[model samples]
Target: MKAAKPLPPYLVRRYQGWKATTYSENSTWYKHLANEGQHPRAMVISCCDSRVHVTSIFGADTGEFFIHRNIANLVPGYEPDGAQHGTSAAVEYAVTALKVAHLIVLGHSSCGGVAGCMAMCSGHAPELLEKSSFVGRWMDILKPGYEKVKDEPDPETRQRMLEKEAVLTSLNNLMDFPFVREAVEAQSLSLHGLWTEIGAGALEYYDPAKGGFYPV
Candidate 1:
């Protein structure tokens, strides 16, 4: 096996900068977190898109949130066949072990995962349809969401609708977990859906009453 390489000079410099500034300023808080444990108030499941900064959006500090990120920010329906499920495991740990009060599914505009799902479902992305494409299989979780906006005339609008649909779909699928359902039913946990626009830095939240997303 090849020996591991050291971090690049630029990344090392960035880390040193952060350690000198953010870490130095909050060393006590960091020490406290190390001594005590993380007791985050919420769990935010967001897309892996680099533009979507979950903590920055909420002004959250370290140890304040239990965050899980994945492609399309999806949560698949409960499947107990013993296959490895990273997202499901994170949700289980957050709900049962962390006992977070709020569980949020955060989707975003201009999501490549959503676009790939659209392309695959529309027969436009042959590569993604291949069995070897992990992204394609991962995005299969959003197929139900794609059906909601497949026929929309405007491509841009359809993408936006599908983005929100991803959030809604995840919120629905999250209930499939027995632990999540029990917590929600007993009023110990609440579920939320959010969509954000990367360019405008605008945010919209799903309102179950109106069955649509509204600016926040």
Candidate 2:
């Protein structure tokens, strides 16, 4: 086993403060929540990157949003199985258990996973090709988006385009869930796609009018 790295002093101090504040101020609510159950109004599917916190980004408090984090925030079409699924399980709990009113597929710029997918496209990481089917599978989801901006003159531009395309594709995939589809058709639920840029701290809102993402 690898040795654990020591926590930075600042982070340790911050955790102490956060713990103190949370226990003192929110203990009653949390205790009730632990006993009764969670009641959230929305479900946010976001990347596993440390920088993109769905609750903090949206200023949501506990019990307001059910969150699921994954490599690229990809939403696969729903499948019923006895198998354990990280993303699908969260979706099932949110839709069936919590009955969230909205589901948001949140994507971000400078995503390492999307970058990995882009690298896979260039025939690099051949070891990844044979052993790791994940990147290939994810890139396959973005195939339509890849085709959309494949002709872009700059390679960097193409990757950025692909990144946005992956977001759109994931949003589309979210709707493929039967519960989500039913809720949406019944007008009880809504779906949204959000694109956030880490470097610029700029959020791009997906616009149906422009048929592309735009700065918010």
Candidate 3:
């Protein structure tokens, strides 16, 4: 393997600054965490979008939340084919090993992955239809979401709805894992779905009783 390129100078400077100030202030806490290992109570599966700041939104400190970011914040149905499954592996470790009490799927507005799924489903993105296209294949997780909102007359509303659907789809798929289902049934673990409005900084949470999302 070839040697990897060094980090950008700006990032190195920012890291140095954090190490000098933030790390200095919390040196004891960081040392404790490193010694004890993490025991986060919740696992947050959020989007890869840079705008979706999980820690900032929840006001979480280091070692508080076990976070996994992926395209559209999706959780694929359990498929133990012995293939390389990063998201599933993360979920397995968080649940079976870490014993996290809650797992939250966090989606957001204006998601490019959701838009790509919509485009692919609506036949607008032929390139994404190819089997080898990684983005297209990953976006396939949102196909069910597209089907749910494909009939809407307004395009903008449909797109927004699909974004929310991504959260719902992941929540549903999380249950498909046998361990997750057992844990939920045993009342040992809980699953949650959340959607965020990037520009408004508003959040909506899924209500199982209402079968929809409500402002939080």
Candidate 4:
């Protein structure tokens, strides 16, 4: 097979700069992290959006949190059918292997994936109905969320509501995994849902009692 292409020159230059500055300044600490395996106390399953920087948002360092990124930051109901389930596999490793005490699902406003689901479910995006569309199939997980907010008349409100619903949907799905359920039930693990208004730099966390996301 032919070799893969190299990274763009800008990325190469950035990496070189990082190696010279950040890596050089923290070489010993980096080596220590390599020698001692990660023991993160939390795991964050978040969207693949470039604007959602998990590390920056939490002011985290290396070996801080186990994180997984996927479109819409979704989690599917547990299906141990032996198929390749990337998100589920990450959850399993974090909960059972890494033994993280907290699992967080972070969703953001104006999510393209959520918008796609809204469009598709409303019969506006026929391509997503195609059998070969991976994104469409993956986004089917959010249809139930759409159903809950389908009647909201205001477009912006509906969009915002659906985005938050994505977090709730994922939180509900996480319970389907036996390990996650056992750990949560045993008080060893806790689940959290968070939403952010990226442009405004505002963050809100879900309160099970309040039944809404509140400012943090």
Candidates 3 and 4 compared by lDDT, better number: 4
lDDT of each: 0.94, 0.79, 0.94, 0.96
Full candidate order by TM-score, most accurate first: 4, 1, 3, 2
lDDT of 1: 0.94
Number of colliding residue pairs in model 2: 0
Q: What is the TM-score of each candidate against the true structure?
A: 0.98, 0.85, 0.98, 0.98
lDDT of 4 by residue, 1-216 (tens): 468788999999999999999999999989998999899999999999999999999999988999999999999989999999999999999999999999999999989999999999999999999999999999999999999999999999999999999999999999989999999999999999999999999999999999999999
| Candidate 1 error regions (>4 Å) | 1-3
Alpha-carbon shift of residue 172 in model 2 (angstroms) = 1.4
What stretches of model 2 exceed 4 Å from their correct place? 1-15, 81-83, 133-139
Clashes of each: 0, 0, 0, 0
Supply candidate 2's per-residue lDDT for 29: 84
TM-score of 2: 0.85
- Top model number, lDDT: 4
lDDT of 1 by residue, 130-192 (tens): 999999999998898888799899999999899889898899999999999999999999999
Tens-digit lDDT track for model 2 on 1-216? 478888999999999998899767998988888998888889888888999977777788777888898887887766677766678888878887888888888888877777777666667756546656766765555556666776888977777777777778877877888887888899888888788988887888788778988877
On the 0 to 100 scale, the lDDT of residue 39 in model 4 is 93
For model 3, residues 37-106, the per-residue Cα lDDT tens digits are: 9999999999999999999999999999999999999999889999999999999999999999999999
